[model samples]
Target: MTSDQYIIQRKVNIVELGATLGNISDACRKLGVSRQHYYDIKQALIEDGIEGLLEKSRRSPRIGNRVAPEIEQRVLDYALEFPTHGQTRVANELKRKGVILSAGGIRSIWLRHSIEKKSLRLKRLERWAAENTNVLTEAQVQALETAKEEKEAHGEIETHHPGFLLGQDTYYVGYIKGVGKIYQQTGIDTFSNVGFAKLYNDKTALTAADFLNDKVLPFFDGFGLSLLRTLTDRGTEYCGKPENHPYQLFMHLNDIEHTKTKVRHPQTNGCTEKLNQTIQEEFYAVSFRKTLYTSLEQLQTDLDAFMDRYNRERTNQGRHCRGRTPMETFIDGIELYQKLVHKGELMH
Candidate 1:
């Protein structure tokens, strides 16, 4: 029977019982229904008959406590940009951008999208980067080829040439007694795994732009290669209004394209993230235990030495590295890059 029919019959049974027993209170007590409820059912039966006794369902969409469409879209965009961020972080980040959303509201939205976990967010980033490869550099086309295999199993990203895609990220190197907090701006060429790093006391839009201007772009320019695109996370240091933000403005002036990882999905820029881990494990872990540093310059001098060995001396087992030094891989790849240029695949 329909729910309405079942409810109507029950109401009828209660009214009939009251009449048969000749005591409304006795009928209600036996049925385990309250007297007031029985009276309400009787009044409904008298007024609108059986139809009035049936309960109505609230089938329409709820109005109150619902998030606005624009706000919802912003939340989803933020999720894609910073997939690793928790609800509190997302809310705080949005607030800085003039979007007011509570952590609970952000969590509710995340629950709906099924990206509440970091892994799901990273998966969404992988899917997004795969589907929207056009936004990525042309040199990154081979990454789509990597999709045939298990990406995580293969480890680092695959690139076409030296300037194909540069993975950039910020690393916190812990606080020194006199230096306060030391942040390292790190970059790596995905094709050759050639790495570059510069130390900074603070991480900001200016510092991010400066890393490229001083260390990254200069190295590529010295080799007469075009730095096509850079990949990073959606941090304020790397992203903002083109005219107002130093990093964005620098990119615009330099004619370099920018791409970013989904929020909390650092592996989208895996080359740099891997380098960060390596630097921490191989260099910082060893160096910190051996030396007591009081100045940024003192520590930086030692870090530069390590970076030199990493690029030119330390052997690597990267897919493109093939058990050669990063500098060797970078040098050998130049010929392959030039041949592609001759084939008209790359600009002359």
Candidate 2:
């Protein structure tokens, strides 16, 4: 029984003992309670029944800064639409719509729902997409496939060092009137959050191999590190027979192992998905409106500059980066990579 029930039962025993003894003083002394305490308990029971015996809590009943239900609902609804967004970004976007909640307040709401982390919020969005796929927009559908918390608390995330596993993906960066249909090939080191991207007019095995040959390998080579394994979704550009397919052939030539995500679950390569979203929101969305691009090279040039800054300047809050730039994390991890390589434990 609960403590309250035990307390009430003991008080009732005191009352019964007094009757059996026919001496209030003797019964009170045996039970270690004063007669006055006994009378108070009896009176409380008579007046309000057993519920009166429950101990009163010392803390306040409600949180002082809890937002109203309607306000909390707005934050939750916004999370569904923008699962990749952090608390500050979420608050800023909400403020644009005239809602005046602070980032801390929005975070408090997220904590209550177990979605304070981007992965947790994405996990929730993943569930929503499963149940409402028919009505989801293009972006929402992408978000669903983009990230899932591989947490034991929620999903399982493997700890990796630099050059361990790089996640790669292709994103259709919307259509431009004069530039034709644009696509981006993206890569991210799962350990350090270091990212790379290149834009092209076509999605093909040629571009996929070119991304690794040109952008990815050179950077790692500069650091004396080797690119080990790559993770990607099952796109035609990534998966094919090693005999003639340019992308598969490239992997075979480089001695790099290839890994593919589950058939429909793109979130397994969440690092690249996250990088794609970052470039989409922080770069392309703003750039497309500010200038008129006449050729693919113009957009590609701007994309390269932004990615340089992202690697060297943008501080990340990921588990490994922890407020440092991706380049910093990448540099720090090189020592660990070398140690593992020397021990002959770096192989898949």
Q: What TM-score fits each model? A: 0.55, 0.58
In candidate 2, what are the lDDT values of residues 1-348, reduced to their tens digit? Answer: 977889888888988899899998999999898999888877888988888766668576366567888889999998876666678767766775788988898898999899998768766865675576534344434433343322211122465689888889888876655667778899998889899998888999999999999999998899888898998888899988889999999999998999998876666776677778788755654454334567889988999988997888766767898767789999899889888889988856
**Predicted candidate 1 versus true structure: per-residue lDDT over 264-313, tens digit per residue:** 66667877877886776456644553455678898889999989978986
Give the per-residue Cα lDDT of candidate 2 at 195.
Answer: 92
lDDT of 2 at 15: 84
Winning candidate number (TM-score): 2
Cα lDDT computed for each candidate against the true fold: 0.79, 0.79
Q: Model 2 segments beyond 4 Å from truth?
A: 1-159
lDDT of 1: 0.79
